[model samples]
Target chain A: EDQVTQSPEALRLQEGESSSLNCSYTVSGLRGLFWYRQDPGKGPEFLFTLYSAGEEKEKERLKATLTKKESFLHITAPKPEDSATYLCAVDFQGAQKLVFGQGTRLTINP
Target chain B: GAGVSQSPSNKVTEKGKDVELRCDPISGHTALYWYRQSLGQGLEFLIYFQGNSAPDKSGLPSDRFSAERTGGSVSTLTIQRTQQEDSAVYLCASSLAGTDTQYFGPGTRLTVL
Candidate 1:
């Protein structure tokens, strides 16, 4: 069975603080790993898609890195606007469904 | 639609009532998806539709939940005899294809009382 697990169920950071959230997965073949940021009362907003190990993608203060067993969403100098639930998902080989992990709730206090 | 759009932004209904939620994907998008999110939980995949091909409904929780995509554009999710546990935000997303980045809608907040 394919599974995704995210660490630090919750995180608190002061404005401008930097930290990384982890998303570990167990699957036979990884097609793509997705990162999304979801705000209250809204659906997830696409952030990045990392396809292979050692691959990295970035947007503004967010950076996503992928490996064989896990992915990292590193937030640098975060602001309150960046505070939201970060979700990680993995699409297995030959499968159309995406298995998601319990997201990490981030609170950035300004 | 400019982006993925879902109808009935908020629906408060009785437990036994059946409900249908609709989604209109972005023009020219070939893939549509449905997902649910419990309070403070991550998004859960419900179904996937690619073009006029058969949909992948592997993630549906039960037989009472069904969905259909018409003309490869609009999609609707129907819940029969809603239960309290079914209350959640039902989201719809669309992408250029299965392997591409998905764009999400605001979601329909369903409440069962």
Candidate 2:
């Protein structure tokens, strides 16, 4: 069975603090890995897509790196406005739908 | 360009009732998808429509859940005989042809009483 697990269900950090969220997966025929940020009462906003190990993408203060079995979302000097639930999803070969992780709830206290 | 859009930002209905949720994918996007998010749970895939091909219904949890895409643009997800467990945020997303990056719309929060 294909499964995605995100660790540190919730994290609280002071403004300007940097941290990393983890997303691990067990699936066959890997295709792509995705990262999204979702705010309260809204749908998830697309962040990055990594298709292979050693692949990395960055946007503003966020950087995402991928491995054979997992992915990491690293936040640099996060601001309060950056606080939101980060979601990870995987799209495997022969699958039309994405498998999502439970997400990491991040709160940045000013 | 406008992104995917869903109607009735919120819906509240009694148990045993039927409800329909709608989604309008981004203009020209050839792929549309529906998903459900429950409290503290990850988003669960519900359905997928790609162009004129048959929708991928493998992820739908039960027969009570059905969806349709008309003209390959707008889609509707209907839930029959709603139960308390059906209460959750239904999200819609769209992507370009042959692409896996999906852009989502603000979800519809469904509340079953």
lDDT tens per residue, model 2, A1-110: 89999989999999999999999999998889999999999999999999999999999999999999999999999999999999999998888888899999999999
DockQ of each: 0.73, 0.82
Tens digit of lDDT per residue, candidate 2, span B1-113? 89889999999999999999999999999999899999978999988889856458887899999998889899999999999999999999998964569999999999999
Candidate 2 chain B weakest ten by summed lDDT? B51-60
- Provide interface RMSD per model, one decimal: 1.3, 1.1
TM-score of chain B of 1: 0.95
Residue pairs with clashing backbones, model 2: none
RMSD of each: 1.3, 1.0
Clashes of each: 0, 0
Q: In candidate 1, what are the lDDT values of residues B20-100, reduced to their tens digit?
A: 999999998899999998876677889999986645888899988999988989998999999999999999999888877
Task: Choose the strongest candidate by TM-score.
Answer: 2
Error of model 2, residue A52, in angstroms = 1.0
